[model samples]
Target: MSTTTQTAYLYKHAHPFLPRTIKAASGIWLTLENGQKILDATGGAAVTAIGHGDLRVKEAIIAQLDKVAYCHPGFYQTDIAQDLATFLVSTTHGRMARALLTGSGSEAVEAAMKLARQYFLEQSPPQKSRHHFIARQGSWHGCTIATLAMGDFKVRKAIFEPILPENVSRVSACNSYRGMREGETTEAYVARLAQELDDEFQRIGPDNVCAFIAEPISGSPLGCMPSVPGYFTAVKAICDRYGALLIFDEVMVGMGRTGTLHAWEQEDVVPDIQVIGKALGAGYIPISAVLANERVISAFKNGSKYFVHGQTYQSHPAACAAALQVQRIVQSDGLLDNVRNMGMYLEQSLRGRLAKHPHVGNIRGRGLFWGIEFVANKGTKAPLDPSLKVADRIHQKGMSEGYDIAIFQATGSAEGGWNGDHILLAPPYIVTKSDVDEITDRVCRVVEDVFTELQERGDIREVDSRVESRKTM
Candidate 1:
């Protein structure tokens, strides 16, 4: 690609010298300008669920465009928007009766936070309490200011410390790999974390806490981590005791990415408000929504006022149309079964191929979302320094091998403020067994090749820098 041509847009996430200019994309594969075929294993941040160039979704968008391209939310509601709300509500199994559509996941999260505040204002003891939100450390809700403030990714939050909202609090994430004590059993770990959350609520005064927000399956930020047994049940109990709402963010792992339509379903914990995105429109268009349960809705339904948030593209006709088609296709085509089967295959393949790799510390995931944690030593569980850019090297090596994967790097995971890197894999739901095999094989090859290159350059060291895992404290 010429510099002049690339100058049309400011591309981030990579350097200008090694730009991977894409020309066309089709089911699970992308064609580069240089004619290199790249397998899109990560689906460009796990957004492409039904795969690229899906004709059904394309037709749906075109049909919607023919009818109407846009409409204001406050004035009128279209059928597509209404139908999507109905479909989303039905999927919630009556736990949620109404929905609010947004342009993206961050907007949905922002709306959810406001909705919680509004709900409290409408309840008895109205305006009497609750201005704080408790979120788990290392969990990612979104990038918007409020969402970022609501989360506790220490590294990501460090730079914006001065400007972030002050009413947000954080608890230790339920990452079994890092949260479980040296000799503690899984049950003990759950009980401990649950107790800790309860303590935090009480310490802050239950009436002063608005909600407990979390990612059902922790996404890229923490390597697709999930809570251990009894964690959600305990968390739910504490929230109920405090009269705080539970908000689940399924931006990256929802909409059938986790076998179940909603990631929270597997845990058997129903949240009062659920934020869903990414796979919602299957990358065909930008769309997201917040599902509010009956209890929360009652606060507004019985109140004298309506929620005062709005976006120009809220419930956009074209985006909603595309998502509606994706939903129908997912159900009619029975893709959830495929997700379960392929997810199992991917997990088994990772264990068989890379479990014993000296530098590969952990392989954890569910459904189509997987993560490979890199370490300096497996037994001691030492992390590669952030300055070494181990995750970026592996990702570049994978790209060299014609595979595109996302490597999410976070500081403060290895220690209180130390950095750790992990490469995340979220393949399109339509991935076949062969695709899974190829993905694992390529990932393994890249990991080995990167390590070999480091050794050749005398960059692989024997220095001792072991520290406690971030979540333990």
Candidate 2:
């Protein structure tokens, strides 16, 4: 079939360039229809953990289909579903008591929002007035209406603002790289953020706030930025003081993408409601989950005895089976250790190679999840023009050129959601030292080549004179 005929029916996002059509993916490489073998560097937005084409996960799905594939979640329960739920709950170490499976991360966040609202209604005092949610600036919870209201991703939420709920408010994200002041200590930064949240609660009326939702490790919109030390503890304290639930979105950074099983574990805080996806099913199936703490679950059990939420495929047997086997392999093969070891190696290699690049402003992340932010002036931390689409160029070059690497690109990470540009690198947990070396090499080359081309074309300008002056000083 002609390319035009094949792509005519598909409606894709508007872009200056069209993306390649992938024919197949195996392990950490994707084979494009044009005969290009590209390395899967970011796991297609940090989704794949165990890598592609696992025979065990395939067999598990087939085995599940042999018995039962589809069943109404409300009327019937499947053993595979039950097993997967149990496994998810156990990961929280009794902090979370129940799991609600969903089709994707957005669905899980939507469920978390509903559960947060229902939890307040289920209380003895019945906090019916507590319907508002507080999320951070530059946060991306999801794309659904309710989640869009809670998120501050301007590009995605701008047109939908009229339809989105108005009960949500925002606070600055705990992004130390940009949020921290010149002389601010980490403790001071945390306290400032906490006070900002407290002030927001007061403005919105604490009694009207149902929950404060945030990603343990900031995802897409913030480019994998982690909070300062003691940040979550301070935020949790504020939530507790105001009697509001704290929801953690671990969709991108959880499921062992970080060194820990759960990103919040490193922060020393337990969330009232937690959402996990992406690597949970390791791309073997489309699945995500919402895990509620005992407090939230107990409130529902004591009041309604139901979560007041349901989907036709909430607990698909085959999806659960695939996830269960993926989790088992992760544990049996000790992949978390690999993630930690290889993560250190990758971090060292990246910083050693690209940290001093003229446009590289910051490089930060945990375990296998890393992000490299670009800037027009490193000294001033000034971002490139948003119109330049620096991150998109790097991503396109990596794929099209001989680099043959796939890296995830993100925009609007510096200030709210406008000018910042960054690329996120989240390789599969099963990646080895050699794999990391190749990824680092290709990434460096891509960035350097892209910037060199922009400079030659006079499309890029020099750093601000003030920033250059500061460098001289």
Candidate 3:
């Protein structure tokens, strides 16, 4: 394969420059066409939990293919799908009563949205008014139009705003880093965010809202920011008061990425509907799931006895088989413990290396999932100009020849502003201390070198001065 700008594959950005071609991947590393090795750091958007090229997962998938590759959900029930759903529900300790498999995270989220709506309809009174969803600013649910309406990432949602649904509205994200007032206690911050959520429900009319969706620990759009203590407890209470379901979009943070099987497990709250993917199959196959708790399941069981949504690949045999084996491996290998242990080391290493850096505003996340927010001014927390593309530049530097590592670069800003330029560093749950050290070393070098080049070009001084001037203004 040759790197070429001209290709039949229509690229996401359609860049004029040619893209690097990966020849193969294995064991937390990628080999390019030229045979250069690159650290598979972000696990291709935090999907690879067991690392690259695990033989066990491959064997499981091959076995699944041999048994059965494709089966229509409406026609027959696959034992593999049943086994995987059972495994998923068992992991949730029966909190989620059933799992509906889907093709990707977007499909899972869309399924969750539909389930939430179907839940309201299943009620005795049939709450037809409960059609709207309330999601947080800077929160990302998925890429579909309904999910986009629920999500507030301006970069992705801006283009199709005119066509997106009106049933979804936004509230401020429970980001103590961004929304918390100076000198405010964590309790106070949590209360304020809860009140804001409540107010949004009132504004939208409590009966008109079906659910309030959020990520337990934010994903790409929010830079792995977890809410302060007691935040979800308060939000749950408000959701209950309004009779709206609480939906947790754990697509990126769940499945052992955040040290726990489910991110909500850390939050002390069980959502009515949960969306998860990315780490489900550990990148061995494409799979995502919408998990419905007992409350929602019971509602459907008594009413229509059916969920209104259906996907072509829902409950796919091969996908579920791949996921089941991945989950078993995660448990068999005790990788969640590794995640916690290695997560601590990764956190320590990153903070020790980058915490005091002038551009690093915040380093927050749990377990193996971590993120570093870049800013022009530390004290004021003013974001570097979007034009600076600090995170993108660092990503480019990391993927370059000398420093060969791949990271998930992201921006999380309210209303398309130039605020949250950050990069997520979620190594696989199987990463070791050595892996953490090397990942950190290369990551630090990338950030340091990118800024150094910017400084040499006098860009850092100008950004700092411009942000400082605005602070005064």
- Name the top lDDT candidate: 2
lDDT of 1 by residue, 227-287 (tens): 7878898999999988999999988899999888999889989999999999999889999
**Which 10-residue window in model 2 sums to the lowest lDDT?**
464-473
Q: Per-residue lDDT for 1-473 in model 2, tens only?
A: 46676555456554333567889888899899889999999999899899989899999999999999899999999999999999989978788899999989999999999999999999898999999999999999888998889888777778777798889989999888899999999988888899999999999999999999999888898898988789999999999999999999999998899998898889999999999999999988899999988889889889989878899989999999999999999999999999999999999999999999999999999999999999988998888876678899999999885899999998868655755899999999999899999999999999999999998988775334344221121
Q: Candidate 3 — which residues are off by over 4 angstroms?
A: 2-6, 15-17, 413-417, 461-473
- Summed backbone clashes in each candidate are 1, 0, 0
The local distance difference test score of model 1 is 0.84
lDDT of 3: 0.87
- In model 1, the runs with Cα more than 4 Å from the true position are 1-5, 11-18, 401-412, 461-473
TM-score of each: 0.94, 0.95, 0.96
What's model 2's overall lDDT? 0.90
